[model samples]
Target: MNRFPLGVWLFALALAAVTALPYVAGALNAPSATLYSGAALVPSGAAVDYNSHLAKMWQGRRGEWDYQLLFTHEAHPGLPLVQGFYTLLGALSPFDLALTYHLARFVLTIGMVLALWVFASHFFETPSARWICLLLSTISAGWSWLLLFVPGATAQVGPIEFWLIDAYNLIGALFMPHFAAAVILQIAAFLTFEAWVRSAGAAWRGLLLLTALLAAMGIVQPYIILLSLPLLLILLGYYVISAKLLTWRRALWLLLPLAAHTALIVYQYVAINNDAVWRSFSEQNITASPDLLYYILGYLPFIIPILIGARTFVVDEADDRWWLPLLWVLLVAMLLYAPFPTQRRYLLGVQTPLAVLAAYGWTRAFLPRISAGRRPLLTGVYVTLTALAPALLIFANINAFAHPQMPATTAVYYSADELIGYEWLRGQANPDDLVLTTFGWDGQGSGGRMVAALGQRVFMGHWIETTRFEEKIAQIASFYNPVVPDEWRLMFLQNNGARYVWYDDSARVLGGWNPADAPFLEQVFSSGSVTIYRVRLNG
Candidate 1:
């Protein structure tokens, strides 16, 4: 009994270490990337659309333009919501608004920790089990890093704050918009599972919450929410089978979340073609095929121990019959089947279960095997290591990943660089002048909110996602695929918005890959990676 309380304290220390250590390192390593030093910093890149839309939401409530920019600008919805809410909380100031955003993010991280505790406490009657659950929650690969470095996690940096990997959406939700969405989803799951397990009767509340959450997630980051649904179902199934005292009333609670989720799906179908977007999934994220083995290893580095523990940890003959086996089967299936040829981000579906498995593994290895005589020494060793792992694994990787000195990749630099240029353009461009760049993700018009931020019009860019973009996405694929046309070059510039073309070094690399004989555009100005071109639109 004494050990349980001690273990809880150890877990609390571990949680603090996991969450706080990385941010300290990031702050110490600050100025890693180039700070946008020029003129007005406008929303650019993929985030432009999300920023513009969210800003539009605040229109009329405040000045349509100023409030939109103030509330929704600066790369994420998370900040806006935080700022917006704080503004509402009092007569708002920028500092208060900023504090509210970070404070909310910190609180959400705590909520996640609390959820892990509840989840662990319920499942594991053994003190060891509780310890493992708490440990796993702090250390799980995606969950831990995601909570720490992501803007929603720290309420700073780029906007890609959603559950997905997109820079824009993540930034959009950092203000706790998506965090709120995710928490609502998990809470619904928690309540439904609670009712399901204890047979506590139907939870109409979980169902209602689930509907609102799914709807919000759909409107914000639809694909991520869609991907998460199957895994959530599997988890729900695990909950339904696990609770020892489940009643028919508890069984009815399952229907509530499901009904709510189903209604949202129906609403999405009527409002937008989900199947259409899903069908494009295979084509859009064509990276190296995800290996089942690699994903499993990523999630569970100590699979053998976990499996051994599951096999060894026997329930009493009177215990819940369906619980252990169902959890195991669901975990195994998710591990084996969750990975596909698509992006690794889709693997997020399996993370929650993997966290559970990791928790189980930690408990089995570290908790029950304690010998009374050596318990103090063993506990000291375990506590020391648990505290160190976050510093070692989480902080080290975040430092490497978020380092500004690292050369930007085609995918990574698009938004940041566009912000740089948009700041410059804000001073240079007149209201009558139009900023021209490549269609989609040419890294020029890709940041439309930046253009809008400058009060200048973008001739055309990726954010518009025009009818011509279907082929543009295909052309983007041509960098890796064989089917794309050479005409993509001129077509991209002329088709959408191009009064003056801006070409970065990346365009040159892509141009070399093109098979076409079209004449290159004339370069008027050259500055490092940023280039200006006046392309004859007709040619």
Candidate 2:
């Protein structure tokens, strides 16, 4: 009759209740069948991404061309993995695809939280570890952000993005073929846990397992996986120099794993550089300044435990062997590579490990000091504060998520306006007729590029990328930016597949330019938020 097991089970059950609270609220409180603006859901731009993929999937599933998802559909290899997972779950039903993806996101979030908690509990003293686990499981920025908001305009500012991040990370963990490939990462995480919990002999096995896990994770998402190395090295270096249990023989075994990991990473880097498929992957400017506030918000709850507990932890002299501050600075520098607007999601991989460190710090510093006499008071205070933390996160996310709203001209897939526009277009166009889209009025209201609006099998529209995509955008921008003559607009239309033109009065122009020539373009449809024109072919 061990009450300890009962206590642990109750604690875990309580954690589950806390985790599902938002879902329960969202289900009951939000409008029927309406998702909250920022709930952790599927991938952001999900409707758009799903629509695009479905078209491609449909072609393939229908036995048209064997599922050719090249440049037109999902451009990256990672997306294919997501699509494949969803496709299997959906089993060819569009409704199922949407429903399943959403459900999968929730499941993924739960799994991530569980994994983090298990990692904490396995590595630390019970009560201290339980606090760390509770804090992380209940109130991380990712946790709040995922539950409180609904999916909307930008992929970066949506709830489903949390699941997407988890999906990407987990996929990298489960798949990948290399030694420290994605699949191996879970093993590595387990091994790392073992190192802290077990004896020296057990720790060596953990290192060997860790090396292999890192190889697998590397295969799944090499960029993030590779970035993880310096931290691992720092930890390994600490164990080597400081641990009382470390003998030359044991150290040799540990170093062997490290050497193998390093060699494999180097090989992967070279192989990726040589491959045409991944050649452009690293070439893109995926850099941005790290948002310290975002990191704080994202990781603060779990991290606070580490901060409070920092002074009591036994710090190995080896901890300072490698300048950890310098390594951290380097990793921070790596954030600068994130592109233009500076996305926070790209930094999730780095943040995950850091949160764990913060948790460890908390346990070592604060948990042991609070005597049993004061425990209830401390627990009550922590719970009260923790309760407010989720609310604050939801508020912050809602405030941050709404700022970069889409313009009226941009068709956001699954948006009300976009759905209306699609209904209008379907009514106006014949089965065989073409409807050419102008810039911004593309694919199913999902803010797709203009080329996406060409609903017909044979049509082209303005798309922004490089060469043609860039050149075409430049051409349209020239007319749209500067006040242009009617004929110039007409000529521009001819250059693209200008079967029809659509404009939204509410859309903000990139430059201060007016379209006085709107009347001359043969106005075919006009509404408050949208305007359509059919260019006279001969004229």
Candidate 3:
């Protein structure tokens, strides 16, 4: 039932290839030297978030099932699912960690592409409709390309991010594998539940399938539960109020899966909120929905069409299939503006359903009214408007990250000396030893977060993962200030559990408190301008 024609398979592969272009270019252009720092280069785009995953995988490679916030020094119990699928990938895969990352991304990208096609196949009967839906769902971006002409637009994400890019499938698939995995599972759960709903009222096997899919999604990508559970509730509501088809047995089919999945969701919620470190991470995990204009422009190609066909299943066809995706689109649309920290996350896989409705609308409602000569012009315009925006976004990303002839040292890129500094500390420092390095946004000081990925702790690293990120930044700044007394600096290091201070050029840029000035700091390793000094605990 999930299989599609050969053309569809090839189309999926092609889309996956599009997602891979930036990474391939980044790798070919990556800089090399006699010695390198860390196990991986900062990924071309989204380096900070990418490094956070590296920290998780590094911990997982060490055989820890629970993941700690390696970017921060705060002691807290590790969360099970927080290690995420990447951690599992690192633990099981024998290849180099960097290679493991790209390999998994490629495979997951393929999976996401195919999964989306299967979902489209279930909705659209005609090949033409299915293909149109595929194009819009996969590559379509907001009309943000127009914004590329605005002054200073080049400085930011420019056209691609006029709305949040993460809302779209192309960006979601290319993001961390977990995001891809989430999309794949979401589509899978969506398909499975629909199948169960259409089956015999008392089909126990269908309930089991629905239960397992929900439980799995809940465990791996729990934030999605925020979207999925409410969807299931509304679907059941439709069966009861709109159709009057749900008998007690049919109710059991939906209720059982809901109950089982709700338990997992509640457990996950309690677990995350209970831990102090993770609580901080959760509080900082804010993605409030953008203004109405961003989304309107972002999804402009499909919005009117989806509205044009919102009643497609009700008027043109009689079946349970359309309600599932239609309601999914509605639920996500309404909730995107709901009061919540993770409001924008409801967008995962939403465009697929919207695309499906848009295609249906075009074929059923809009195309029939248009003249034959005008239809071709409108179709071309629609296709171009949808595809060009995201294409430009991809090109912008590649231009910024992959075109550089030589890799420059930045917050993301490690210098030879910085790499040497990290390698020395890796061998010398014990597990959980907190290393002090000031965090900076980009360029020289930015690479400090990687110190955590190499298996040491950082006093502060990730802006989000580190507890009280601003407070820690202030503390580090004051510690390095020239006015701070040596006596206070010595006590500060010991108080915060800093066993070693990685005083590099970046750190020097912060203040004039040289390692030499602090007699309590015993210089143990030095490479170029980077030096590692052990805090004298007893002196």
lDDT of each: 0.42, 0.42, 0.73
Task: For candidate 3, write residues 1-539 as lDDT tens digits.
Answer: 24777887787677777767766655555566432222222233366566677777787889987888877777898877664677788798898776677778778877887787888789878777777777777877667556556786446444434335467887766656777777788888878776666666578877788888888787667777777888877777777677776765567657778888888878768988998888998898888876666677777888878777657645775766677777788788888888889888788778878888888887777877899879768876887778776676566555645544444423334567777777787788886888887775442353345543485678876777778887877888888899988888888888888888888776887887788778899999988888889998884
Task: Give the Å shift of residue 189 in candidate 3.
Answer: 0.7
Residues 49-160, model 1: lDDT tens digits: 3333333332322333222222111121122221233233223323332233344445545555555555566567866556555554444332223335434533433211
RMSD of each: 10.3, 9.5, 3.2
Residue 373, candidate 2: Cα error in Å is 3.4
Winner of 2 and 3 under TM-score: 3
lDDT tens per residue, model 2, 303-378: 5665675554446333432233235435644653544333432343443444455555544556457786885677
How much does candidate 1 score in TM-score? Answer: 0.57
Better-scoring candidate (lDDT), 1 or 2: 2
Candidate number of the best TM-score: 3
Collision count for each candidate, in order: 24, 45, 4
Number of colliding residue pairs in model 1: 24
- Give, for candidate 2, the lowest lDDT window spanning 10 residues: 171-180
